[model samples]
Target: MSKLEILALSGSHRHGSFNTALLDNAKRLAPKGVEIKIYEGLDKLPFYSEELDGDSIHPEAKRLREAIASADGILLAVPEYNFSMTALLKNALDWSSRPAGRHVFVGKPTAIIGASSSILGSIRAQLHTREVLHALQADVVSRPEVLVTQAATKFEDGALKDETARLFLVQVLDNLVAKINTSELIKTASQEKAS
Candidate 1:
């Protein structure tokens, strides 16, 4: 009955990025009892380096890890760049999955949605992002995929305006919450079995 918190990461840092706008819409469309917190400072993270990760982790990386650990779920607003995910997003993932076994992403529920001005709607980026999350052992939502193609036409005043896109965004948020609840239940069951 407590509120579910989802950490949202925007893969783009451009002013008025479509992916960032998608995240804003996601925040607005999230269901009741769910809170979508959009994370900033992705651009401030230093490039991942083992030397930098040792002993004293970068403050930004530590902040990213802490946010991931505290959230019940993650939502990624990915953007396509040359048929791949942006380096900024890849960098965040690298920082989040660190120290070989102390990463924050293992078994965490996540959902991915993207918007692009192109007709493909960042599908390639989303696919790559999903693959990375899987590698990190994150539980990713696979249904009601939200790919807002030709996204330039889908927004007004920096908010999602397309009715169909809005509807699908709602479904994505709902599915994310469901995945989180299911994950919690599974963890409880495993604990009970062990005890």
Candidate 2:
């Protein structure tokens, strides 16, 4: 079987964002045969507007769309902003969902995780993100939810040094991979049926 392509996205724009660090750690813990790439240009995307999405869309937006289109699944690491997903991350999703018929987020397999200095650990933001993904027709993994609270203490030098957090992240990845594989199988069968 071919390796699964997983695109990782960090919603935080802070230079030392713990959420982004969490995603880095996730890459380190990914299992064999699972290819992971981080999407690092969310800050460059403009707010979504149909009028501006004509023949000349922003290059950054185009790049993000292409990345999502080619990926088998998405792993989002979000940071809570006033108990919600950061505006930057939400805007990126909005941009990716435009040109309605050609939406890049539709039917994509996704998993959400978050880290925060707060005790709640961005759990609310992750939940909100899952709802948004569902609205976009993405299949979001519901189990093994990851919310690393007190992130400053949990991670070090962009790595998840905590044993428990690492284990939880592994389970989250396993669930995401399973969901992606199942979706691919379903798509293949449907195509076969059409044939």
Q: How do all models score by TM-score?
A: 0.97, 0.96
For residues 1-195, could you state the per-residue lDDT of candidate 1 as single tens digits? 789999999999999998999998889888999999999989999989988896888999999999999999999999999998999999999999986666899999999999987999999999999999988999999988799999889889998888888999999999999999999999999999999
Among the numbered candidates, top TM-score falls to: 1
- Predicted candidate 2 versus true structure: per-residue lDDT over 4-122, tens digit per residue: 98999999988989988888888888988898898888998888877668699888899999999999999999999998999999999988887774598888889999998899999
Against the hidden true structure, what lDDT does model 1 obtain?
Answer: 0.92
lDDT of 1 at 124: 92
User: How well does candidate 2 score on lDDT at residue 95?
Assistant: 89
* Model 2: CA > 4 A from native: none
